[model samples]
Target: MDKAFLIQFTGSMAAVAVLVGLAAWARIGRPSPGLDEARARDLLAEDFPDRQIDQLWIAREGRGALARSGACALVLIQVGDGYAARRLSWCQASSAMFRNGQLDIRLGEVAAPRAVLAFDNWPPKDLAA
Candidate 1:
């Protein structure tokens, strides 16, 4: 290999590495901050302005939340750097299993399919309805 060619290739690789490091430091595409009940409600409000959440439960470590509005249920999940909301009836969920104070709900959708919410007690009664 020619010495000049090798030097140029090495320099290009270093430049790419530096750019990646700078992007990481800047938190480009970094995930959104953890959510509280109030923040989760705000996100739901944006996507579901007409609906009001009657009850809500925030997931462990702020991963997501479960909320009930009238007869419909809504889930707030983290997608990339933001949150996404899905409204569902109880029948829409493929499954919901509770174990160790967590309720795992499967919505059976292609985009936002599943959510695991944590509660201090067992799953809420209205969750199944």
Candidate 2:
């Protein structure tokens, strides 16, 4: 193979690798068995000790959860090997809706919101709804 061709092939391969990495990073863990409301509250309780959890719902697939604590809505996602959560409040430009058995809550700007909580077959009243 020509040296130039090898260089181009290597560059293309690198680009592909980077794209794959980004795609993987964009998604969290696969659905699991521990997304129930009790589990969600227990998880949040570690961080939000005094606040009351008004509501919570685990996605049908168990990949994500959403909850209302005090004045803010907490969104928890399975990230990496553990979990990650974000708080969205009415103070920000947050909006929520339940469509087709999925609850979608978006906070802040239209681009991506400070946090986006989308739960499949979510239960309870959504904070923004």
Candidate 3:
């Protein structure tokens, strides 16, 4: 390509990188506001009555929750009403990423996508992968 074109493209890319860095820095200090265990337990209990919740992560503003039981993994995300639950039995997740302000976890697919959970990362954890 032309020298001038390459220079302009490099400058634009650098600007984009700087903006992304600033956004990430802003999210650094703000820790996730954890969820109430009692409420989370109650919600998890609704779907998984038999299986006990082993691990739980809730969004800051009570937007969503990621819960794990002995048998399966459950994700309760805010749609329109309250929180809708998505269950994963075999647990074949491919990738999980937290970006901008949302946490997106992708599961393995057969015909279409097996499962996908998109929630806000509260008590923001390091999602460097």
lDDT against the true structure, per candidate, is 0.78, 0.66, 0.61
lDDT of 2 by residue, 1-129 (tens): 999999999999999999999999878555456577777888878767777877666667676776777678777777655667666784342345667766556645454453334555434445445
| Residues 1-129 of candidate 1: C-alpha lDDT, one tens digit per residue | 999999999999999999999988887675668899789989899999999888887777797887878877888877777778888884443247777877777877777567767766555554444
Tell me the alpha-carbon RMSD of every candidate. Answer: 3.8, 7.5, 14.3
Q: How far is candidate 2 from the true structure (C-alpha RMSD, Å)?
A: 7.5
Candidate 2, lDDT over the whole model:
0.66
Q: What is the model-wide C-alpha lDDT for candidate 3?
A: 0.61
Worst lDDT run of 10 residues, candidate 1, spans 120-129
Model 3 misplaced regions, further than 4 Å: 1-35, 89-94, 106-129
Between 1 and 2, whose TM-score is larger? Answer: 1
State how far residue 43 of model 3 sits from its true place (Å). Answer: 1.4
> What TM-score does structure 1 among the candidates reach?
0.71
What lDDT score goes with residue 15 in model 3? 100
> Can you write out model 3's per-residue Cα lDDT over 92-112, one digit (the tens) per residue?
322355666666655443433
- Models sorted by TM-score, best on top: 1, 2, 3
